[model samples]
Target: MSNISAAIPPVRWGILATGKIAALFAADLALVEDAELAAVGSRSIESARRFADTHSSGARAYGSYAELAADPDVDVVYVATPHGRHVEDVMTCFEAGKAVLCEKALTLNADDGSTLIEEARHRGVFFAEAMWMRCNPNIRKIQDMVAAGSCGTVGQVRAELGFVAKPDIARLWDPELGASSLLDVGIYPLTFTNLILGEPTHIVAAGIKSDRGIDVSGGATLTYTSGAVASIAWTQMAWSDNRAAVSGDGGRIEIAPRFHETTGFSHARNWELDEFAEPVLGRGYAHEIIEVNECLRAGRTESALLPLDGTLEIMRQIDEIRLQIG
Candidate 1:
């Protein structure tokens, strides 16, 4: 945990890309007291100005991402571009000596993810993957409880996340954009399972791919050395329950529907059930912003809650899954 001091100035953020996710992140930045949207960047000048006008009246708008990276007032850049462009965009921020909070699935594969991490290390700049679910208060609480034996010797895990994505969405169907149901939604269940089971000793996966050679639905079973097993699934072609559970000999923990952004969960043990709830700020993105702010103030280069090595491991897992399914 970073030692946060009230004396530290607010961390200035630069948004690189005016996409839907980027807009949501910009809105959530207002909920963090120690974070400020200092700039907005887009390929088009008009788009940049529009986003800045809507999200932050005082923020500067840049027609090019390089201009935003070069801004002296910007302390960190949020790489909100598509996963396919992460390596290039993040490198731009690092070149400017600015910290970064990149969107999840850090890149198309672990190799590119490692490349960005190496560059960040060489530049001595703070860098973190924006895996917001790991930073959620309720998720963290569940992790703590499980670690403290509240869940009692976990043995099995099951999780799934899916939604009916429209066919017209280019980013969802375009192979060049790095579109895949696994990369978009499967990552959540995979991360959730890994959090409970650690690294898997054996992985068996199968999936359905689109005609464009992108995975649209998939499932994987992971076996651990502890004899524990996890079954996870994801899809972009249908709406799933989006619930997750961890079961052990002692008890079971049930996360609410849409587990990734869930604000509450329940624990059942010995015929007694207990409910737990936590406050989620601004659609649950504020927690990550708060984390980044704290790390910046404490001069930390990586977030403990969302470690870089963990991100790399998850990327490698995704790589293996892709190879198996492809």
Candidate 2:
């Protein structure tokens, strides 16, 4: 737990779900001084209690999400359920008058996201998609440099993110669970491209379907209005040499591990590799926690780093790709 920023008033947090992603987020939150692990909720009582004890001693463990959300000690909730369950779980928090930071693939589709967003707006509560990579300091630095025209007149950006999937894993293979390589893994590369280029005017995609009828591997080409293009690839059938590069008239920039982890970028003109490392509290996930704290402090419900509009646009593209492949 590195103290990258001074601890502000601690934001009491209720963690919903007792899954791998939930555990990762809870561990990360424990590293942030301004983030309090107030409660953990799971459908199973034993799992909820175990998760709480493992990450935060004396933190409340609720047998149900409702119990966690209604806990007066909790100021906000983090939803870490699977993609298909996002809308129901997130809406449970919002309906209970709790602010939410839900994990990405915000919902199964755009309509569900719009419904959640509208609910949050009507309730006057904060709602955010946990697009953690967008808040990573190194990623932000790249965005800043690009916006500053450091990479001048961006030409083409290419990014790929993939890892071989365990064939028997239900979440990765189940179609009824809204599983797809495009949503689960493709989103990372798609998002990486969109982050730098904004909404694409044209998107072309192709993919091989899984035994369960989900995308197992795929590629996409997104063309921006500025005539810039980004090509991205994702796969669940095999591991990829995941990396990202953006080329411009003036120079090119490289992103190591492109999707997650500590990112380092280099500009081709200088021909020198420079690493921009930011202090990450726990396993580098505290950056998003800090972002949430800053937004809450500023009385803002949405974040500019992972803005609502950007989320919607990206989801629309994902939906389009799924349709095209289907």
How high is each candidate's TM-score? 0.97, 0.95
**On a 0 to 1 TM-score scale, where does candidate 1 land against the true structure?**
0.97
Model 1 off-target regions past 4 Å? 1-7
Model 2 agreement with the true structure over 1-326: per-residue lDDT tens digits? 33435545588889999889888888888778777888999999999999999998779999998899889889889998889888888888887889899988898889888888888888888888888888877778888888888778998999998898887778888977778888887888888888799889999999999666889999989898999999999998878888888888877778777445544566666565555565555666678888888888788988887688788888899989988888
Weakest 10 consecutive residues, lDDT, candidate 2? 1-10
The lDDT per prediction is 0.93, 0.84
Candidate number with greatest lDDT? 1
| Cα TM-score of candidate 2 | 0.95
For model 2, how big is the CA root-mean-square deviation? 2.1
| lDDT of candidate 1 over 138-238, digit per residue (tens) | 99998889998887899999999999999888888999999989999999999999888889998999999999899999999999999999999999999
Best by TM-score: 1
lDDT at 317, model 1: 96
